[model samples]
Target: MRYAKWTILTLLALTVFGFFHYTLPQHDIVRIVNTYQERQDLDDWTRIFWASPDDQATGLINRDVQFIQAVDADGKPHVYRNEDTGWSWPPYFKFDTANLQTQAEDLKSTAEAPKWVSVTHYGWRIVYLSTFPNAISVRPVEGPDATIIPWVNIVILTFLAVILFMLRRMWLQFRERMIDPMVEDAEEAWDSVDARADQAAAKARGLWGRFRAWLDTWKGRPRR
Candidate 1:
């Protein structure tokens, strides 16, 4: 019974911890990102932004996570929809590229790039392609070259590792607290516990390996 509960907890932890980073419009091959930073406050970790199309005061209520396209005009960035006229955002792909490197030294004085960032531009849209593990903000799908090396997946991997460790600890505690002293025939019960645990673990490992393998093979683009 305790093992069942612990198993459930482990599964739940993996589910929750799996959300290492926010990826929007998962159907897209490339994620859209903010290009012009002077007027934007992108929160890459959550893939949210400080401001939105309407209502820009001094609170977090205006934060938006949707992909946006830059209007060709030099006005403030607006909420671009699929139906918007001219320079509209598609389902995926875009970037803004106003890098802050030469701004500080020049009198033009453009907006500074955020403390941690790696940006790339795709026409009117911007894509944040990568960042450090502990950065506060990042572009949507913009960290650690996800296809080659999924850092967020690594975080989730660590989460699974910790969960496995805790489950092992719990199993040990369960044995010590519930089963060890209770069984009169210690030898037989011990043998049974060892056999059942080994079987269950082996089965779980095989299932996990198969699942991961299937996930890897699911990488190609879907048919139209």
Candidate 2:
């Protein structure tokens, strides 16, 4: 049971960690190499990775998706899908897909004369699943080694920590003030019932013993 409890806790922690890792914004310092638009088929399970830019387009089987191609400081390639989240999960509320695509195009650079830029995005690039991280924003950086401070993630995580701490404190207070008193009262009531039952049993035994002694007197034996 102890092992099972720890296993459950471990799995729960991993799940929460994965959820935050996927949802929270991440940064990649890369040089934009290209930008293009292509028709994407969304009639499969991979649709979850894409966005619903239009409410009416939700039922559509396919749509045109813009993409940005870039390479990291190590010269490794990365592809990001440009889509509007617009009142959806992750809540970036991005509606500037065209503007972002233009920015990516303008920032395009060759291998020798690289103009490094930071791509702020969320999601994962799963090649096997044909899913790309959705790019949120793009901004130029001093160099590929620019130190970007993740202030947004820091604020969000700190706020969440404070909330969890407050909730735990509330739970502890409730247990101390309400639940503990009720439980103690129940235990005391049960103890009193057991005491009464023991007293009744002793009284019954005493009466039966006295009756036996009286019978012994009739038989000419001295009463006990």
Candidate 3:
């Protein structure tokens, strides 16, 4: 039982970690090699990995998705799919798909004179599943080794921590103000019932004593 409990907890932790890792935005410092658009078939399970830019276009099975190809400072190639999140789950509110693609094209450069840029995106590059991270934004940096602080992640985590703390405090206040008082009232009612029962028993004993004394007078002639 103990092992099972630990295993369940571990699985839950991993699931949460994977959820955030896939959904949260991350930074990759790379030089843009190229940008292009291709028609992708989205009629299978992989459809979940792609974006639905329009509500009216849900019936369509295929769409042209723009892609950004780049190589990192270490010369490792990375590809990002540029698609608008459009009022979707990650809530990036990014509606500048075309504009981002144009910017990526402008930043494209060869290895001889590399133009280092930071790609801020979310999702994962699962080779087996053919999944690519959705690029949220792009900006040019000083160089490939330039450091970028994840301010968005820091702010989001801090806000979540504050919300959890506030909720805990509210629960404690509810117990102190409402639940505790109700419990005390129930205890007091039970004590009152017990006191009433004791009084009833004492009154019954007193009546029995008076009856016994009255009966003693009837036995007086026999005693003489």
Q: Highest TM-score, which number? A: 2
RMSD of 3: 6.1
lDDT of 2: 0.94
lDDT of 1 at 91: 22
| lDDT tens readout by residue for model 3, 1-224 | 99999999999989988988888899999999999999988889988888877552877788888999999989899999999888977888889999999999999999999999999999999999988999999999999889999999889889988998999999999999999999999999999999999999999898988899889878776655
| Colliding residue pairs in candidate 3 | none
**Residue pairs in collision within model 2:** none
Determine which window of 10 residues in candidate 1 has minimal summed lDDT: 101-110
What RMSD, rounded to one decimal, does every model reach? 25.1, 3.1, 6.1
Badly placed stretches (over 4 Å) of model 2 are 203-224
Model 1, 1-224: lDDT tens digits are 99999999999878764443232222221222343222333445432322122323334432323332222123333222221111232222222212222221121212332221222221222335321111112233332233334454467568989998999999999998888878757888899999999999999999999999998887775857
Span of 10 residues, lowest total lDDT, candidate 2: 51-60
> Which regions of candidate 3 are displaced past 4 Å?
169-224
- TM-score-wise, the better of 1 and 2 is 2
Q: Is candidate 2 or candidate 3 better by lDDT?
A: 2
Q: Ranking by TM-score, best first?
A: 2, 3, 1
TM-score of each: 0.27, 0.87, 0.75
- Tens digits of per-residue lDDT for model 2, 1-224: 99999999999999999899989999999999999999999999889999886554688899899999999989799999999998988799899999999999999999989999999999999999999999999999999999999999999999999999999999999999999999999999999999999999999999999999998879985668
